[model samples]
Target: GAGVSQTPSNKVTEKGKYVELRCDPISGHTALYWYRQSLGQGPEFLIYFQGTGAADDSGLPNDRFFAVRPEGSVSTLKIQRTERGDSAVYLCASSSLGLAGGSQETQYFGPGTRLLVL
Candidate 1:
């Protein structure tokens, strides 16, 4: 599809557990990003991918978070040793091109995956 979609709309996990969130971006998109949003805060960028390579990953909180895109299409965000504070909405977005001219390009966001860690 030419639109973004995420699997497992909701996830509940205990502390120290592991979780994987998936994101499927538009068919030909070359730029992909993952963000996390707290209860009332806006999404904070976690990672960015250009094609299948991670263009930027400095936004990830720590080593427990990771993301991958094998074919430059579908991406997955993996979290290890989940903590209660990790509970939030995981958002995925894709755009036709990278952030070349700032926020002028069209970026499509998927309905986020709600993760609750206890």
Candidate 2:
């Protein structure tokens, strides 16, 4: 069972550029979530998916941020028109479904994709 993993643990880019961060969740996980955390702040939920559909995406800051889980496994977060304010740690997590209606789950976080906008 692989835990959540993210690529480019550190990314440095200029303003107005585009970046795509990848996440690989644990096997057999059907619930996936993406969160962004800024300095001295808690992780803000970006999007959540059950299977291949986005169940929640209200946390996305703007149109510049988008994510997809096409196959219901690996997910990618794409950021367009990068801004210095976008610099933060992108975290991905997954969990199992309990007997309850929704998944009674605990998120297992990845090392995180750290993006730096210069």
Task: Give lDDT tens digits, candidate 2, residues 15-66.
Answer: 9999999999899888999999999999999999988899999999999999
Find the candidate with the highest TM-score and give its number: 2
The Cα error of candidate 2 at residue 18, in Å, is 0.6
- Taken over the whole model, the C-alpha lDDT of each candidate is 0.92, 0.92
Model 1, global lDDT: 0.92
CA shift at 12, candidate 1, in angstroms?
Answer: 0.4
**Model 1: residues with Cα > 4 Å off, grouped in runs:** 98-103
